[model samples]
Target: MVKLRLKRYGRKKLPSYRIIVIDSRNKRDGKAIEELGFYNPITNETRIDIPRVLQRLTEGAQATRTVQNILDRAQLIAKEEN
Candidate 1:
């Protein structure tokens, strides 16, 4: 199964995450099929590729709880923009 989740990166004290699509059997940070967005928890910032994200979501990829919340918020923001 393909899953959408966060992959950690950045320096020791500061952490940032990439929202990625990968196979469920793989290790958390092993590799990714696609990177749909990024999130910086410390700064509370997000950058997402909505079209690609929606495409993957429609194609059956599952999101982790945090990712789901982020996606939902991004969708709401997108809707407001259009």
Candidate 2:
């Protein structure tokens, strides 16, 4: 199964994440099938590829809770842009 999830990376105290499409059984930081966006919790910042994310979702990619929340925020941003 393919899942949309976060891949953690950065310094010890300051962490950032790349939202990626990866295999469910793979390690958290394992090789990703595709990178969809990035998030920084400290700054509450997010950057998402909306079209690609929608595409992946339509194709049956399941998102974890955190990722789903990020996507929800992204959706609101996208709606406001237009």
Candidate 3:
């Protein structure tokens, strides 16, 4: 399975994250299929590749809960109209 998730980086106490697509079994900082965005919690800043993210999502990559919340807050996903 593939997962769209965060890869932690940066110095201690000042972490940054790269939103990446990777194999579910890979190590947290292992190789990634692609890097879709970046998040800096300290700055509350985010940069996303919307098209790539949507493509990965359509291709069955599951987003982590935090990523899901970010997507929701960014209004990146279309709501179901059932």
The clash number for model 1 is 0
Prediction 3 global C-alpha lDDT: 0.90
Candidate 1, position 10, lDDT = 97
Residue-by-residue lDDT tens digits, candidate 2, 36-79: 99999999999999899989999999999999999998888879
Candidate with better TM-score, 1 vs 2:
2
| Candidate 1 lDDT | 0.93
Q: Which candidate is the best by lDDT?
A: 2
**Which of the two, 1 or 3, has more lDDT?**
1
Model 3 C-alpha lDDT per residue in residues 1-82, reported as the tens digit of each score: 9998999999999999999999999999999999999989999888889899999999889998999987776664345532
Best-to-worst order by lDDT is 2, 1, 3
TM-score (all chains, Cα) for each model? 0.91, 0.94, 0.89
Candidate 1, residues 1-82: lDDT per residue as tens digits?
Answer: 9999999999998999999999989998988999999999998899999899889989999999999999888889879999
Candidate 1 pairs with clashing backbones: none
RMSD of 2: 1.0
